[model samples]
Target: MSSSKNMSGGILACENALQRLLEGKPVLSVHVGLDVSKITASIVSLEAGFDRGYLKKSRRAHLPILAKIESVRAEAGKGSNSSSAKKVQRLEDKVLLLEKELAMVRTQRDRVLTQNLQLWERVRELELAERQNKTRQVRLHH
Candidate 1:
């Protein structure tokens, strides 16, 4: 009785990256990491000067589902200073940490549901046994 719900998260950048990669252009460097939920993933786009308009060649990037987050550093001069870069880095780290927490919670919830189902099954078994015992007792008295 475990039905699944279908959903999709659109990533135009990823689609574009894959297309470019397939067209013989190496996938512009990006740190793609699977969200802790493992349900969806995000790829941090890097490499400036990417011509998003160039869509003549469409191809799949074939990037793996769980790509490693190599390194996330603000592009040089993108930030006002190194402190800003550090701040960005910290934010990304926090996001990744939160994702991990979310995944953990999901796993715990699944485990709890399974345990509940088992308990309900046990209750049903006990109820059936009680009913059977009552029938036996009545037959003996008769």
Candidate 2:
């Protein structure tokens, strides 16, 4: 399934679980092989809570499940923060490498341009010498 659809479904499932907890209902565990579907749903819930500050406001309700959710959220938050920091660092390194490559290319271009100008100057000098030599030959023949 697409990530957005999967995330929305997971959020809905988590909301149902939370409502069941609030009403003191027994939560049914949906087992799919070794994976606990409840945890997947809870993770989505935690992401939304952490991102939107919903869990912070819900803390005033004093529910047992909220405490458990808060602890899990704290752990997840730490892991995510560290992973995101690593990704940012990697991207910065790539940018630095690319910038260095660009500088090298620019330097090479400047050197080639200078060489081209020098070659053109030599061609002009050769043409002028040829013209002078032809004039001297014509004078000798006369």
Candidate 3:
């Protein structure tokens, strides 16, 4: 009985910690005696918050709970029985769209960078030619 009580208490503490995290509050791993990384990984697996890239770039300690709540609401809209399946499909579609968009943006960035490099090379060539012309004129006059 005592063991069960302790287990229940631990569970309650975990639940409370999760609640606080969801509320955009800071939760220390030491306070909850839980691995924050594991908890965040589970949240990421559930597709809560933004994409992995955004999360890594932002270096946020916890996932944004608002996104999770919105996702849950969107999933709930399609009935409970098929919600998970539909949500997975929807998320997959979103990933595909984002991937395509990312590819296009990368192509544009590459093109722009190439153009910039070419412009700098042209500028350097022009400067060198002008300097050579000035040197030639100076020698001819002398």
Candidate 1, residue 56: Cα displacement in angstroms equals 60
Which wins on TM-score, candidate 1 or candidate 3?
3
Put down candidate 3 lDDT per residue, 1-142, tens digits, no spaces.
9966764554344445456544445354332433232344334322333233322313333234334434544554545557568779999999999999999999999999999999999999999999999999999999
Q: Give the clashing pairs for model 1.
A: 18-61
Question: What TM-score does candidate 1 get on C-alpha atoms?
Answer: 0.41
| TM-score for each model | 0.41, 0.45, 0.44
Every candidate's CA RMSD: 20.1, 12.0, 15.3
Off by over 4 Å in 1: 1-81
Every candidate's lDDT: 0.47, 0.58, 0.56
Per-residue C-alpha lDDT of model 1 across residues 22-131, encoded as one tens digit per residue: 34353444323322222112222331123433222232331331232121122223334765788899999999999999999999999999999999999999999999
Which residue pairs clash within candidate 3?
A: none
Query: In each prediction, how many residue pairs overlap at the backbone (N, C-alpha, C within less than 3 A)?
Result: 1, 0, 0
lDDT tens readout by residue for model 2, 1-142: 5866765554455566555543435234322221121333344344334333333335433244456556655665677777789899999999999999999999999999999999999999999999999999999999
If ranked by TM-score, best first, what sequence of candidates would result? 2, 3, 1
